[model samples]
Target: MILLKCFMVIFVGQFLDVTSVYNPMLTYNIRFNKLRFLPNVTGNYTIFQQKDKQYVSGYIQRPTTDEVNKYQLPVFHRCNPEGLNCEYFQSWTLTDLCTLLKDKNQIWSKWYGAFDPPILCPINQYTYVFRNSTGEVNIFLKWYPDVLNYQWKITQKLYSGDFYIGSYYNPMLTYVVRIVKITSYPNITWNYSVDTYKGKYYVNGNTSITTDKLIDKVVGVFERCAPEGINCEYFQSWTLTDICPKLLDKNQIWSSWYGRSFDPPVVCPINKIHYQIRNGTFDLDPIIKIYTDATNYYWKLTQKMYAGNTLVGSYKIETVFLGLSRIDDEGGVVSTDPSGLAYSPERSRL
Candidate 1:
């Protein structure tokens, strides 16, 4: 039977930041139990080949005092010359180390060293102080075989610039970063704002204005990072002009137009008269009125003439010639013939 076992250790601290040091030595040692192989009575044995490539992968979570106390171990793995023990070592700058630490959660508690607290050193000086603290600083060191292929899953979206603001200076616009589905890591949504006024450009606020004066011409770069600040993927570089239009509010109103003659005239035989303004235009306004008499039904169409805002005259249609004839209340027979004289229909009534 093959057996596997894993052990974890934790250290706590308060703060962790980058230092100016170029390259600092770091090391970690891991030990494994002796291996055993079954012996065969009679057979040809083949030797297995192994590669020397190595890699380290692990994640740190925010550590609490109770968890640290429960997980702490007394004996530390020591380097051995016999090759039974594995020792991993590397040299890293303060900035590089800080970047790695930022990817971990509760970073200060899981990896800080009790004997060697990280210190800032002068650029010209090679020597730096490494002192022990109760739980003030932190660093992480570990190693494993390359086959482990360690990866860190992003839990939260990280943002750096002003993605949204109430006001903006002339020629500088605010923008935002949006990340869609990520194939490398599933179920992670990254969205944040990048504000120009916050001076996020080049990690400094100062930027010279270019000749382009159009508010839409301004552009800003946005990034999405896994683990907050390390190993980020460039999501989008958007301009304020492009995004502002989408944020504007829109209002629209729609009106219905009614009134066209039916194939068969509608019969209105009731005592109540009904009137409807069907079509109203600059040139023509048509009003339809329907009523009933004791003996016969009657339908009337009227048009009020207007020259600009001044009312010139009003005309009523004769039922015998609905479209061709019109009778004016003040000026009878308003419809004219080709000779420009008023023409009246033979049966012009009601």
Candidate 2:
């Protein structure tokens, strides 16, 4: 085998100064949402206070005998107050999850340790549970304290080896941690849905579909605009045919709505005689769900069925990314905090 040496590069971008009144993102807290793609790994951790000092104590278990030497790469994202205009705040490649504990170079390193099945370089297959761990948030802010004032979403992923195109390594772990300045979780606040017969996207005010290809044309994109809601910038869009298979992932994450109590067409068959969406634009499930922490941003999605070149019927939906809500206590649709809802990694508790 030919030996090859590769260099890792760090690219730092411009950061909006937190001192500016527009981005005073001070005072933040962290939350983790645990989601397992594979069954071999499972764990949970939380931040606790002891003797005026805060620390994290928890465990990450490996039920199988598989071990990995690769480290986790974390990418931090900072968004605007409206949860729009997100940019990378900072990032780090953690060679050891216990670096906050064993790295003597860190100031508080002496105060932390891995108690059960210690975590050192080249992580072992044994389950890991640590006490007197580094203060989750403190160690984070020590590098960029000014960042605490804004909203942040950090995603970390680990693999068995170098992350490349077709090298082929199973995903070992993924961590998604959200840091916010406020307590309430961000969710959509939808106003209304277009009517079946009188909606704007309806062709010549017709409500029935003359074509069997109900999904002939589809457009989905995220849109942002000026405070006045004018002069908007439409991001790139995606074209999809049958949105049926995409529903599986959405059902897992947004279980509250796409749960067992809910069901849609299994196969969006187009080779039919006549198709009619009796409700027009209502009750149509979205392709993407719960990825955004932005309650203020909206997605414009349109789907249309056609007969030759004539437009028969169509549906246009305008909703915030997090707006595809769940049922509330009184049977009304409502969007709430993402704490217990999102399919994310609950990695931090500050």
* TM-score of each model, paired residue for residue: 0.14, 0.47
How close to the true structure is residue 17 of candidate 2, measured as C-alpha lDDT?
36
> Candidate 1: deviation at residue 58, Å?
24
What RMSD, rounded to one decimal, does every model reach? 36.9, 14.1
lDDT of each: 0.20, 0.36
List model 2 lDDT by residue over 1-350, tens digit each: 11001000111111233323222244322322222212334566665655544445676665544445444444556655333345556656654555444665552343234456654555555566767554244444566655444444444344455531111111111211121111111111112222212111110111223344444443444455432235667755554554456544433332222233222322344434322222222122222122322333334444443434545455444332222234445543344334332322122111
Model 2 earns a TM-score of 0.47
Per-residue error (Å), model 1, residue 307: 45
Error of 1 at 36 (Å): 43
lDDT of 1 by residue, 93-114 (tens): 1223334443444323332332
Clashing pairs for predicted structure model 1, backbone only? 11-109, 12-109, 62-106, 112-138, 162-194, 162-195, 163-193, 163-194, 199-205
Q: Provide the clash count, candidate 1.
A: 9
